[model samples]
Target: MTAIYRSAAGAAAVRDRYDTLLDRWPVPSGRRTVRTRLGATFAVVSGPVDAPPVVALQGSGGTAAHWLPDIATLAGRLRVYAVDAPGEPGRTAEARPPLTSPAYAEWLDDVLDALELPRAAFLGTSLGGWWALDHALRRPARVTALALVNPAGIGRRRIAPLLKFAGYRLFGAWGRRRSLAMVAKGSPADPGRRAVGEFTFATFEHFKPRLEAIPVVPVERLRTLAMPTQAHFGAHDVLLDQRDAAAKLREAVPHADVRLAEDAGHFLPGWAGSVVTFLEGERS
Candidate 1:
């Protein structure tokens, strides 16, 4: 299969930066490598052995380490497994599955089977949220619960202004930063803000994400998620309207809990505790 990266050198450079940030991971962690039809999948596990498994997915151009705050927060409470999504800028396979089919769900099933976990909770951000919802709809029995942060796929994808593909491909770093500036809107005092900026910029500059437009799943399809589900969105999200996404989700899944974070943008203010509490309700 053809690698998704724009260039081998770019991929290697991004990986070097990814490894550098990962080396600074504050928590104790273990790495797991699983083989699936999609390709080799990688997940970073943290937290206690006795706790229930909670698989997490990050957004576009994001790696498992991007969920560092969530992993740290859920350390002792739940065993967190952050999957480095295949086809993205991570340690996972460069082969991207078609977004139009059940390929993602099947790939996830393979990962879970390889890990010997039958049913575990799920938490996803942006594109990850879309994948989580996809899995829940396709393999409902495998997902114990669902949580999303500024997730896409629930509504029509909004067009991003001033962030053109040509710009990213031609100008590189500057264009990536221009795009990142729209979402890396954390509090200025955030000590990790600089690192996040640097990482995202590098990801955009190096990783070649699938250009396929992620289609909106049918409402009837979304209605099949029977597990406890919560979806969170940033009020000021530049990509999608949180209120619109919330209304659509509530209409599709009447029992789903939806929230709009007042201070959050697309990147979101970390709400790991809120997600953990919701998942715990399903367990306890």
Candidate 2:
């Protein structure tokens, strides 16, 4: 059995917690299990049946449940598919594909194929942003639009945040919470956000995360994305060089809409409205 948790019990605990959050999903939603070459992928589907489709990807070590706060607003306009990527702490396969290859884009191709979507927009955060960007670069024809939040693979990687996180780990649970709070700045103070935060803490308590270097998307390739693209960066983010990332993206794709939030960090909360507006505009 493929698992990202330290033990089977840990996996069950995470799943149970995730399920509980889904039970409180502010809007009507359903689960989707799509077969792909990488493995069986899972997505929490929301929105109207006839609405424009958008596939959402979460950050590393996160699941679809993390998107609960945004679903109600997002599903109000377009069809939303919050996908749990392979190798992450979700129901997806535990196949850790190499970051340097085209495997991820191909896996996404299979997902789109199974979903029967000829074209769709994409919403991704951090590692998920990198995956969506990779797919857009590899298959520009299929992506209608792009929405990235504190995405990786744009600027040079820094070691300070990783080292700081390591130091926090030495102090045990208290330190871990500090690490999460420090890294995930600007999380909204809402009930759904709180539930997600609790679930995140529980997940990291027993889950093992990927340690490989996140691959950077070459700046030149950014020009190939003819589709509408909007990227949001948090100025306080410690995990990535958000300023440099935003600069490079603006330089490469001059037409791209990029925003840098001075008060936000890597985890952007309370910004779902802007994302929904962007995606909804694309449909018209």
Judging by TM-score against the true structure, name the best candidate: 2
Compute the lDDT for candidate 1: 0.80
Q: Rate the local accuracy (lDDT) of all candidates.
A: 0.80, 0.86
Model 1 stretches astray by more than 4 angstroms: 162-174, 186-189
Please write out the lDDT profile of model 2 over residues 129-176, one tens digit for every residue. Answer: 999999999998889999999998997777887788777777887887
The pairs that clash in candidate 1 are none
Across residues 106-204, which tens digit of lDDT does each residue of candidate 1 receive?
999998999889899889988898899889888888899999988888865767642564466477677666666766554243656567656866676
Q: Candidate 2: TM-score?
A: 0.95
TM-scores vs. true structure, each candidate:
0.93, 0.95
Candidate 2 stretches greater than 4 Å from native: 1-3
